[model samples]
Target: MAYVGTFSPNHSLLFSGTKHSLQYPASTRRGVVVVVRAESMTTEKLGIKIEKNPPEEKLTQLGVRKWPKWGCPPSNFPWTYEAKETCYLLEGKVKVTPSGSDESVEIGAGDLVVFPKGMSCTWDVSVGVDKHYNFE
Candidate 1:
């Protein structure tokens, strides 16, 4: 049977990666994107998925004065992964709680910082804030 719209069975298998996935405000959300394949997954037992890259021109066009949030779920937390990220706090504020750390820092507008993969942090998002994000 062909599954549709945000439904994934236990035995379901999806072999693909996101060239780019954009998260919206989520009121009119629809459909299941895809599932991870059994093979080619770096952290199989850990349930990690391999993601594809997005276009450069599109990324470069990312606008400012928006709210963007990055979250690392307890289930998908990377043990030791590293990626250079560009964080431009356009509005409101965000707090990142890194891995193995009990404290977090609040970042507001014009506060630019970088967080590596292994860093575990509970992203505390403000009531209404969205940002244009491009993570490599």
Candidate 2:
């Protein structure tokens, strides 16, 4: 079982397991904790990750606006990443199909996407794309 949880720093408590158990420090009495079960999105197969409608705080933290911008009209092309690439889409839609794999991922505006280094994939742009991208 997998669990995801968030708590305020004011709480001095530890949580363990899917069925969460809380242990508080001797000095602290009680606090509020929120826990949710995690649903896994499998990215290990293609090494491509698409985060849909990521929070503005996450975008700001990644400095997405500071990265270089790239745009392309509706088209299809093959690309291989020499380095890991992270990008935030501002507009348009795209479908990326990895080489030798039938599965494809669709991404569009308000999405944060990551392409692992050495990945070979096809970019099928149905709508023009405008994005800020960074290579690491």
Candidate 3:
């Protein structure tokens, strides 16, 4: 005797090096990160797997990158992404410019910022900078 269910093939385990343990929702009996493939409940039939195929837009799992700048730095122009990002300042200060906004964010050590996904922004780290980030 056995039973079957549905699951998402892809899901964020952890944003960065941050470890995580999965908990079954009240409605769920028990589960794993991935589950057995079933035919009866196709994506449409089960209202799951909404995206047949999504673009591959993967970045570093857990990464730390240092950015330096010259006096009166112009800006740190990077590509906009669809994943929410949090930055931890290790040194220096930076001005984070989010898309659709005129004001920018200035953050320093022990300071964290949650950047909304799909934000177009620039980084202006005064006195150079070092930072650690977690993105899914």
Among these predicted structures, which one has the highest lDDT? 2
Model 3 per-residue lDDT at 20:
36
Give candidate 1's TM-score: 0.36
Clashes of 2: 0
Give the lDDT ranking, best first. Answer: 2, 3, 1
Off by over 4 Å in 1: 1-82
Candidate 2: the clashing residue pairs are none
lDDT of each residue in 29-133, candidate 1, tens digit only: 345454432321111111122111223332345543343664422222223335545454444455555556666555544344445544445566553334444
Question: Against the unseen true structure, what C-alpha lDDT does each candidate score?
Answer: 0.40, 0.78, 0.45
Task: Please state the error at residue 114 of candidate 2 in Å.
Answer: 0.5
Q: Report the CA-based lDDT of candidate 1 relative to the real structure.
A: 0.40
lDDT of 2 at 117: 96
> Which residue pairs come into collision in candidate 3?
none
TM-score of 3: 0.41
